[model samples]
Target: MTIRLVLAGCGNMGYAMLSGWLKSGKLAPSAVLVVEPNAELRDRAVALGCGSAADAGAIPADAVPDLVVIAVKPQVIRDVTAAYKRFGDGRTTFVSIAAGTPSATFEDILGNRAPVVRCMPNTPAAIGKGMMVVFSNPLVSADAKRFVADLLSASGEVATIDDEGLMDAVTAVSGSGPAYIFHFIEALTVAAEKAGLPAATARLLAMQTVYGAASLAAESREDPAMLRKQVTSPNGTTAAALGVLMGDDRLTNLLTQAVEAARLRSIELGK
Candidate 1:
């Protein structure tokens, strides 16, 4: 369906989603209106051929978008969303990407009848390879949920959760998963340097190895454990490495703990 979208912010995440929508033909430039306080950011949206304004109040009074995306930071979301309250008259669906903010918050501000969607998107969304997870309030129609999913698919894969409480777990995993991978790369690079490789070569080896392994894992028909078995030979170098990382399920346990910690923190922040 053709959707008229109102984007409430034009920051990195906002611009990334906007770019994806336009590039994927999900939404046309003429159908979007971006409201950003930052001149530079607003200009960036304007450059994409979307309508732009310094504030929501500047938007035409008659404008009633099909979707109003609240992409501003959580701290200022209340004030920013208040300006667009007129659009929340049961017609426009509100989608928020702000972490820790719940659909209940929007329901409180925009009235109980307004359909709302809460999404958790990671940094990789900027590169179009992200994992976008969404939860919608019951007021949202099935068609609106599909439209939201279609818009998000432009960024990457999209998943839907029936329980809103699980969002904290989703945030801990996909939302913060990239940082864990990045740290692993750093550690691998340092280990390579200690093993006598030149710094530049070590960095390249570490990066490419991770990238290749991940790509292989993603594309391979076999599961990761089976794939690992395929590469390992008895008493070989790969076996020795696996002996350390897999001993007593050390790595698995460590990652589980890390995800739990992040999930707890997410719950705390939500409060």
Candidate 2:
């Protein structure tokens, strides 16, 4: 099916998805309509050759989009959602990338019968290496889920959860996970500097190591644990470092605690 997308909000995530969808040839520039109140952002979309409207009401009244993607922040979602309620005609499946906002929130605004998919995507989506995790309401049809997944794959890896409750964990692991990786890189760079490397050299080493290791893990069929072991020989420097990181599974326990904290915060936000 030719999925005509009506994208609401053209902020960072929205623009990234639009770019990926277009660049990946998943969606034609002409097939997508951008609805953004911000003139600057809306103009960016139009510059990409998409149809733009200042508001949902401004969209041609006869237009019927297969998917209406809401990429606005959670705080203003309520105010923005009502404007597009007219499109909740069972044919259109609404997809939201708004964090901390539940599907029920959209149902409350767009009608309980509306088909909505709640998705969590990280900042990496801006560069097309994002992790997009989604959960759909029972009302959504099989074909609609498949269609939305196909579009989402343009951004990065697309995963679905059968239990909506697991979304909180997904949010903790992949949604807030990028920040953790960034912080790790920062810490590693600082450590390298303290170990006597110049600032620039330390920074480059830290980033390149992380990038190369992650790339290897992604492409290799071997488990990350196996790869780490492969690099660590008995009484070697890597083994020395592994001893510090794995002593009593210290790093594992710390990470588990961190993920739990994030998971609880995500649960609180949804409430």
Candidate 3:
């Protein structure tokens, strides 16, 4: 069956996902519909040859999409969702990528009968390297779940959790994880500069080092601990650096606290 997807927003993340779907050829432009209030974004979608509408009201009544994707901000969820109530008779599955908004929120707006999938995706999704975590309502069918999983794979890795409560932790981890890596890159660059390297050289070294290390970790058969040990000599520079970082388990402790704080904040935002 041809699946019709209706995207409610066409901002950065939404646009990236749409582009990925089209590029992967998993979805044809004709199979997609976009509703974006911004003229520029709507025009961009149009340029991609997809059906574009400035508002949900502009979408044809006969276009009963199989999946309605809510990519708008959480604050405006209700406003955007009100446009699709015509499909709320329990036939369509609703997918949301708005952070901090729970499945219950979508259920409240889309009607309890609507099958809702709440996903948290990070910024990297724009580049097709994102990690997405999803939680779905009980109403979602097995076939619909598989379809959603396949659609999300266009962005990158996708994982599903039965418990909606775990979404807060997923938000704390993968959703906010990219910023932490970026911050580490910045710090590494600054430190390199302080050690007498030129700013540009430091930046290049920092970024490339992080990129190479991450790639190695991903591709290597060895565990990360083994790889770290392989790089650190008995009393080498890496060992010295590890001494400082591992001393009192300071880095681990700090990261644990940071993740906990983020998870708590995610819970608070959902509430």
Candidate 4:
């Protein structure tokens, strides 16, 4: 509760992470200072008992937080981060969740003295079921890396990568992975409806099946391939379905192409 963190945006993602941290007791409300330009968003942060400000300049001069989280849009990141260069003396670590913005952007703005961590988080993070991957620059202390990982875990699973280049792959796999799943749900729902299920039931079956299967896959010790085989019988109904979906690795190849397309787009955007 010592104002150890500065949250530069209080929009949906920022609010979700903040609420998760507070709910899990990973951070106390008094430990955060939220700088949200929008009055409504700032009010939401204030409602949670944290200090709220309209901008970085409004933050108290005496407040030197351990972390400064940038959740603003990537386009405005440079302008937004320029105001906090005073904290770039290697004491405060900068963490960014802006899509397509690299850690180097912060280092460029804050200078070599600043430590930066770039995170790729999926939309599911809003529901505490996200995949959060981070890549930190060399200047980030060992303890700071662990602390950032722990804080991110409040929202969901956390992973770290040594190679920043792999972040493009991360962007494809987890960052954009939710949309893939959502599309699958949409396809499945339509398939169900075509197969004679009511619209509501089709939607329910599609969503619940995906949700339950994902939960099982997550909890089971067996790998996904093994789990897939467990429910498939020789020339049975599941096998019949698998024949259409997995014949000649059709689904696998299709997904590979999709992921590659996304990875390439991510690389292009980063530049």
Candidate 5:
């Protein structure tokens, strides 16, 4: 199928997905339409050889895009979605990446008969290494699901959830998880600096260690628990560190609390 995509809101996340789609050659510029109110962003999309418009109304009334990707913020979703409601003739599917907003929100705005797929993607999507979690309403067809999944593959890993409620957990884990890692890196760098190492050296060590460990975890067939045990020799430095973190399950408890907090907040934001 010659898929036609209409991307609303050309912000950082939207632009990253767009760039990935283009780079992957999954969709041609001519087959994509970008609707961004920002003049500069509209020009940027136009420069990329795609159809650009300041509003969804600018799309020819005769045009029936296969997918309409809503990449705007949650606050602006209602207004942004209103622009594309006319396409809900059962031919177009709506794919939203707005955090906290539920599939029902899109359904209410776009009409209950309209197909909607809610997706959560993190900032790492800009580097094409994002993890996306998706859940769709019953209105979505199998073909539409496959189409949406293929489009998202341009960014990085994509997983579909049978239950939309799990999206809250997904948001807490992977969506907000990156910032936690970044903060950990920052804290490790500071600790290294306090250890009498040069600031530059400390930063390099912390950053590279995190990157290498993450890469190893990704490539390894062994479980992360096994990997951690492999590195923690008896009565060694690693064990000493683990004593503080793993002792009394302190780290696990702390992280569980953090994730639960994030999940509750996600539900609040959705409201």
Candidate 6:
């Protein structure tokens, strides 16, 4: 069956997912309707061989998309969802990647019968290395769930949860986790500069090191703690750094606080 996807935003994440779908042959470019109000972004989608619409009204009247992926901000999710009510019948399944917004919100807008999937995707999705997590309402079909998973897999690793409440932690870990990694990269770059390395070289080293370490961990599939131990020879330089980062549970305590703060913020946003 042909999959007609109505992507309701063209921001970085949306565009990235679209590019991945096209590149991976997961979704045909011809079946995608890029619903973006911004002229530049809509044009970018058109350039990639998909149909572009400035608003829901601009979409072809006869078009009943199999899936409507909402990538808008949490603040405007209600309005954007309301605008697409024409497809609220049981035939179309809705997928939202807006953090903090629950599937209940969409069901409330589209009617209780609507099948909504709430998703949290990190920014690394832009590079096709993101963590995409989703939770679907009971009304969602097995086929729809699989289809949505296939679409999201183009972005990166995709996982699902049975409890929607856990989405807050998901938001903190993967959704906000990229920003944490980026901040770490910045901090590492600065430290390298202070250690006598040139600014350009420091930045390159920081970025490459983080990237390589993460890639190795992912491919090795070994426990990260085990990997860290592998790198730390007894009483060596890496061990010295680990002492600072791990001794007294410093890094673990700090990261726990950060993630808790983010999870609380996610809960607040949902309210």
Instruction: List, in order, the clash count of every candidate structure.
Output: 0, 0, 0, 0, 0, 0
- Quote the positional error of residue 90 for candidate 1 in Å: 1.4
Question: What is the per-residue lDDT of model 2 for residues 1-271, given as tens digits with 9 covering 90 to 100?
Answer: 2439999999999999999999989889899999999999999999998998998888877788889999998889999999989988777899999877889999999997789999999989888899999999988999999989998888889998988889889998999999999988999999999999999999999999999999999999999999998999999999999899999999899989999999999889888
TM-scores for the candidates = 0.97, 0.97, 0.97, 0.98, 0.98, 0.96
**106-137 in candidate 5: lDDT tens per residue?**
88887878999999999888888899889999
lDDT over C-alpha atoms for residue 149 of model 1: 97
Cα lDDT tens digits, model 4, 166-214, are 9999998999999999999999999999999999999999999999999
Weakest 10 consecutive residues, lDDT, candidate 5? 1-10
Query: Per-residue lDDT for 10-126 in model 3, tens only?
Result: 999999999988998978998898999999999999999898888888877677788999999888988888888887778899999998998888778778799988889888888
Error of 1 at 231 (Å): 1.4
Supply the TM-score for candidate 4.
0.98
- Residues forming the 10-long window of minimal summed lDDT in candidate 6: 1-10
Q: Write the per-residue lDDT of candidate 6 for residues 72-190, one digit (tens) a residue.
A: 98899998989999889888999998989988889889997788998899888888888999999999999999999998898899999999999999999999998999999999999
Clashing pairs in 2: none
Q: Higher-TM-score candidate among 3 and 6? A: 3
Query: Candidate 2's C-alpha lDDT?
Result: 0.91
lDDT minimum window of 10 residues, candidate 3: 1-10
Each prediction's RMSD to truth:
1.5, 1.5, 1.3, 1.0, 1.3, 1.4
Clashing pairs in model 6, backbone N/Cα/C closer than 3 A? none
The ten-residue window of minimal lDDT in model 4 covers 55-64
Q: Report lDDT (Cα) of residue 130, candidate 5.
A: 92
Cα error, residue 254 of model 5, in Å, equals: 1.0
Better TM-score candidate (2, 6): 2
lDDT tens digits by residue: candidate 1, 1-271: 2338989999999999999999999888999999899999999999999998998888777777889999989888889988878877788899999988888889888987899999999988988899999999998988899999999999999999999999999999999999999999999999999999999999999999999999899899999999999999999999999999999999999999999999999888777
